[model samples]
Target chain A: MNPTLGMYRPRNTPMHQAPAWFKAVLLVVIAAVFVLFTDPITSVGLMAACVLLLISTGPPLKATAQGLLGIVIIAALSGGFHVWRGEIDRAIDLAADLVGLVALALAVTSSTPMEHMLDLVSRILRPLRRVIPPETMGLMFAITVRAVPEVARMMSESRSAAKARGLDRSFRAVLIPTTTRTVGFALDLGQALHARGIAEEGDNPAPYRRARRVKH
Target chain B: MIEFLDAEFTAPDSGARILEPTTLTLDERRISIIGANGSGKSTLARMINGLATPTSGSVRVDGMDTVKQGAKVRRVVGFLFTEPSSQLIMPTAIEDITLSLRRSIKDRTEREAAAMQILGDIGLADKADVSVNALSGGQRQMLALAGVLAITPRIIVADEPTTLLDLRWRAHVGALLRSLPLQVIEITHDLEAAARAQRTIVVDHGAVVFDGDPAEAVEYYRALMLDRAVGEPAT
Candidate 1:
């Protein structure tokens, strides 16, 4: 099984021990600053600061490098577009903005456990418990976070299944089974929720109605 | 007792009959159901918890109608799916079990404590906070079991729980299932595991063709498969 992206490393460092809310707030502030300030000059400074923060995390070098490689691929295309337009300055600044955000997010993710992140999300959504089950929101986040790597695993399995059947070159052969299995996964999830008593009535915890009541 | 009275299933898309009408009262502590793929055994097992509600008639657990009292029925009838990864919804081990305890325990610390105890039970105490993605197949299955057991259901309906496991994990999970004090209804293709059950039911072409001792049911299933393999219609 593939480890989720930016896995949390259980460490005793100050950043690792920081409250999830604090990191979340910091992430929001970073986002807000980027949104509010459009100047390329400021973005370059922001990028440099994010790099320092990333280094301070003492990340697993391999994962960070792999993450950066992916980031560079996307940023390179966009940066090339800007450079070709004769806006070299804009190209540099845009790359900084892109890399800065990813580095910040990665640093935060590496420091905080997903449980803490979900708890923070649950607490934030507490006020909405009246209209939506707040805890269910956190569960939704957990499921989504868990599903990504699982989806990747399923894709690989589907690919293997296709190769065994000599249909490796056909996209439809892969897509059909992957899609079906994913749908089955979702259906099974509902049954698991119901069996766990998570979908009880008035549980309104996210508008999920229980399985249809059998008529007499 | 988990009872099915005239319970049946019909696939909506193909309008194909998935399970024929059947009636039985099952109260055995360890019951096994065996059938070939697409034989409707999973459908029959799922009916106990309303996962596959009968298209006609009804299923009841301990006098509680599965459909009318589904929430209550579910609270007492734990279900373990074949895929541990699909069932382990939370990000971490303790978190998944804690989520299971959410309805039963309100206090966060207390809930987590109980979850830790459960992980300890399954020997995953050290991995309590580890990402579920990092778990091996056996560990993941154990975690899934911990979540289901955390609910303390009176009866457990397992739908091919060991299908995805390796030889070691199969025996490990099989022993874990057998050791539970609760009543268990397991659907499996493993004849050896089926033989451990007090009773077994064999399903074929969406019908319960045999309901008797596990040994006999296993023989019946083997014969049925042999017939199909030889291009002869099953009797």
Candidate 2:
């Protein structure tokens, strides 16, 4: 199974040095601004700036383009729907806004490691420590992010194995094992955490307080 | 050293017994547990680290109770599964090892440094930052070993670690596991590996049928397989 998502590319760029939470907050704010303010020129400018920032990250242009394929497809489909409804200008503006938002989000993901992003998320969610425990949330986020590429790899392997066995057409054969294994993995991880003393009750204080302390 | 006292395991769902009540002690630096598929051998090996708790009886690692103190037991008992992908929980090789060190090393920078040191020791220093998914089967297995080793457990239990590897890679991994300083308990179907271990235990239907010298254990297992084949008429 190929586990590499190419999202955590190691680089010494300034963007990589910025605290992950700051970048995440900035990306969210930019997205909200793009959605709230609606001039096509403004959207295009923001989109262009995001593209330039992406280019400066030094990931291959082809790789970047390949990663953005889903966004591109969504933009095209939404634009088509808008034109079909006879709102051509609105469609173009929405497409630009969507592309800008996607680009901004991609930049954050590309530059930030999953651990840092989870830490940042945990830090932001620290105030809810009484309700949901920050470390648990951090671990959940990290596991979810980490499991995405792993699950994808397992599914691809299962598909190839099924195809090789001439059972590629059977969705049950592929899906059953994949789902079973993913659940098994989650259980194993929970066990591992318990074994490692990381999940013990009253072991760590609320995550937000820790983050605040780190900030100072 | 590891010891099992009157251990028995029954499948919770089927109510079918896998491992019959059995007891044995292992003090060898390198030991192998050999058995056929569905023979309850892996379950027996897992009991060493509290991975599989016995339905009855107790398992002890150097006197630590497997059931009552499972977390404490696991801290000193490192486990390696047959599939490295199953053991590796992180995205990158270095990160995977570092995750294991989260408890051992509190400082993030020191944790990363120590993980790199372990990677270098395991010959995976060059692939530290590489995504674990891109590694070959053998490389991934080595990375898994590195992750377990990073925790610096006293005893290592590996279940069919080389089953998925080719011959050369199998030998390479076998040699690597053998070279470690920790007490090693490997569960495998590989006779050659069994022969190399300081002691061998041949398990059948969940009980230790033969426990002694590696050569005698091999002979006992071979004969047992032959007896089974003879007992069954041609399909």
Candidate 3:
């Protein structure tokens, strides 16, 4: 599966130009509809529509298919489980529903930049600004998204380090280093955030004030 | 100008000295700090931007107290880390730079354009939308620098920024840092790079053991290392 499947791919398609909040709402509504519909043919048709929508976003079809491989495996396993229970029609509907939902979700994610999503989130949560700063939540979301590949890289590095030391078979050997590295990464990230003046904007600069005006 | 007015740092829990009391005014366009590991070089550099506050005396950048005016100080100072991955908070190059401009540029399209412009200047224009994970170590460091530059800071404090890079990337990043039109205080183990600075300070045992010409500071640090090696028992 493609590690970068959900990450925005630069494109000039209509999907890319659509507002992030609109796509988010559409994704939610479509997901709800997919769950409500139990017919195999309808589910398969919806899955095809999702696939078409994803293709229209202009990302490489081969790469997109590769990214959906893990989902396909999960859907197949689920279908097999349902078939074992003597529910052939239910198996097809469930498998199609899973694939369709994942595709639609990917369509939204691949076309929308993370910053736009954060902006949408900040607007949604702006009312709760007193209790929880939307900017802090946005930072948390960005960091969590950023850490996905980093954790994957660290895990591989830890595994390699274990293998080099002839401890490849030991799960503890790999886990320890990976966990330590993750904690260290988090600390460094916090320090970087501090250095960048994030969460410390008491006396906002002229450009910042002007920018806030522009944003509003 | 950055001033360390008899500033000192002590471990909060252990009450051990991390940086000994010292006073220095730094106004040079390029100043390098060199020291052994755990010798308080990072502590000194970090204080300039208020990442680490002094335990007793105060540190000021252009007369703004680092502790009291931390946010203001941070605005004037941009910091670069040894590990670029740590500094990068976004998945893509353009997005990371845009994140840096989040405060300064409110308009989304204009901010993205500004980020793209920075990427082009840094020769990462083609990789603007590429995932940062796909970048080379050198390119990642360059992107990290781009993120720092997005704020248009007056001073930059880099703590071992090139220590993680290969020889080629090290030279590239070192040259880039030198060419930047701002005050730079770098903490590095690279004696050659240290010598390129206008002035150099040597830290040892949590004290500024030597502060003068870059060449002389390097020589003093080398001699100090040799002296320590000769005096210590062999492991």
Highest TM-score, which number? Answer: 3
Clash-forming residue pairs, model 2: A2-B133, A3-B133
Q: Score residue B119 of candidate 2 by CA lDDT.
A: 90
What TM-score does each prediction get for chain A alone?
Answer: 0.80, 0.79, 0.82
Worst 10 residues of 2 chain B by lDDT: B83-92
**What DockQ does each listed candidate score?**
0.54, 0.28, 0.47
Q: What TM-score do all the candidates reach, one by one? A: 0.90, 0.88, 0.90
Candidate 3 - chain A - TM? 0.82
Candidate 1 segments whose C-alpha is farther than 4 A from its true place:
A55-58, A157-180, A205-216, B233-235
| Candidate 3: segments with Cα more than 4 A from true spot | A38-41, A61-63, A85-94, A203-216, B13-15, B233-235
After the best TM-score superposition of candidate 2, give how far the Cα of residue B128 lies from its true spot, in angstroms: 1.3
For candidate 2, give the docking quality class from DockQ.
acceptable
lDDT of 3 by residue, A1-216 (tens): 344767789799999999888898989988888889998898899999998898888776777888788799999999999999999999999999999898988898889998898788778777776556677787788788789778888999899999999997999999999999999999999999989987555423344433433110
The lDDT of each candidate is: 0.84, 0.79, 0.89
Point out where model 2 deviates above 4 Å: A1-6, A38-40, A125-127, A161-181, A184-216, B233-235
